[model samples]
Target: MEKKKNLLLDIDEVFCFPGFLDAINEFLESNYVLDDFSDYYIDEAVIPQERFNEFNKFLDSRNLYENAQILPYAKEVLKELDFIYNIYPCSSCINPFNIIGSGRLFADKYNFLISTIPFIEPEHFIFTNAKYLFKADIQIDDRLSNLNENIETCILFPSYHNKTISNDELIKRGILRAGYDWRTGWLEVANILLDQSQIKDDKIKRYLKK
Candidate 1:
């Protein structure tokens, strides 16, 4: 049997559509004064520990875990790609303290993904600050900043954060490719990898066809 190619996938916006900032804004709109809170990505220290507790509790109450929706083409594409590559689900939760405030919290969240996403074993899930440690052949992630030039990386344009930056800018800067939103972007990734793999297969088939 041939060894499968390694493919790393990001969660959150990639598979599940939580609207990360949107959800937080909704929580703030209900309880806090939004007067001067223009920047959603505020430093973790800026938020009083009490307010952070409330936010975390709200997230857990909503059962954000169960509410996660698989991206439009994710399920189908994973089914096809599994035939050729080992699909590993990798994700990073900003500020480890946001969940349960320690390494244990990270472990619990990783376990949640393993239970939720079928075909994804707990061993394949990784929750870390440094994504490059995994050493995969390719990685598909939505955050452009996370792109590592050394690897074959695919930068996925996030739906909520469509800033002025273009995918071309990311590639020129060093990313392999930048795709549009998750739904269609994932399919394009699967096709591109498959096509590359097909080229090798085609060469072998040429002599047989003759």
Candidate 2:
């Protein structure tokens, strides 16, 4: 029998929307700083140390861990996928502190918030600078540039940050074949993966019943 393929899912933006910059702008405004950091989108291609530090400060100061909101349908999608495939939560950290300390802190906070959800596990998590190190069959992420063509499948979850890259451009670059921006799309992803998983289990039955 062939081994089961693993599905790697990104946490931030993909599952939880960390309102880090937004929260910073709110805090700044309350403190009388008129500057709006709301328009700031972390540029994935560029790694500016100063800008990174500023971003980290924003996360640290505001206690952003509790503020992170799980995207709509994210829980349902994860539950559905878990029934069929080996699901792994994979996320990349921007700041050095995030990779070392902040990452674990954020994970702990996230797990606490979503503790009501029984299927989500902390041990199945991975924090890394290079996501490619994990040999996954599929990776679902919001950034198009991070997609590795050598991987089996890369699903792009559209976001405001990636406005410059058109869907056609993504396909042309061989980054992704299909993209989605809402929970409905996430459900479709679950259905696709579940249909592929050969496991005959109660979870699969429950999802099918729905």
Candidate 3:
């Protein structure tokens, strides 16, 4: 048997929508929008000091995560990916300033995953800002910084915030390899990783239950 490839999947923007950026604008009454996200760091990408502080407070809300909605095709595609890849729903719990949330966000994230994608067990879930530190064959994340060169295959997940970035610029920035941009929709990613294993593995429980 071939050793399975470990695929690290980012949770926030990829799995859910209106990500932190919109959440920021919604909670703080800031005018920041997706196009405003130019930097890898939100502080630089959107607002500075005061509003950034407010955003941090919003992250601490359990109700926010609990009420959050899943992105289009997220549940179905993830169920398919779960059948084929060693799916690890990785997320960043620690902030850029090395500040961790008050544990409420962590629980909220956990509960969200379990309730949303119940098939993804708690063991496969990872909460870490240092995603590069984790060993994986392929990684799918929304941030350019999150996709490290060390990962054998890095696929950047696109969202409203990152849609403006051109494929050429992504390659030029050294974030994505050549010929690897503009094809990261969930089903596209599913085909790239699972065409060879479309037949669900017998060991794990199947999603469709046919």
User: Highest lDDT: which candidate?
Assistant: 3
Prediction 1 global C-alpha lDDT: 0.59
Which residue ranges in model 2 land beyond 4 Å of their true spot?
Answer: 30-58, 94-117, 177-180, 191-210
lDDT of candidate 2 over 71-178, digit per residue (tens): 666776677667656777777655555544465555554554457346756677776658867778888877665666677778877554554566677777666632
Instruction: Give per-model TM-scores.
Output: 0.68, 0.69, 0.73
In candidate 2 the C-alpha lDDT for residue 112 amounts to 46
Q: Give candidate 2's TM-score.
A: 0.69
Q: Write down the TM-score for model 1.
A: 0.68
Expressed as tens digits, the lDDT of each residue in 156-206 for candidate 3 is: 777545666687876765554312323336555555555544645433223
Clashing pairs in 1: none
- Model 1, residue 57: distance off in Å is 4.2
Clashes of each: 0, 0, 0
lDDT of 1 by residue, 1-210 (tens): 888878788876677654434446577663432222334344242456678877766655444444556677666556666667787888776554454544434554665576666676667877777887777777777666665666665555344444445656875866644354445665566555655434333432232212
- Candidate scoring better on lDDT of 1 and 3: 3
Quote the positional error of residue 16 for candidate 3 in Å.
Answer: 1.0
Q: Against the true structure, candidate 3 has what lDDT?
A: 0.67
Better of 2 and 3 by TM-score: 3
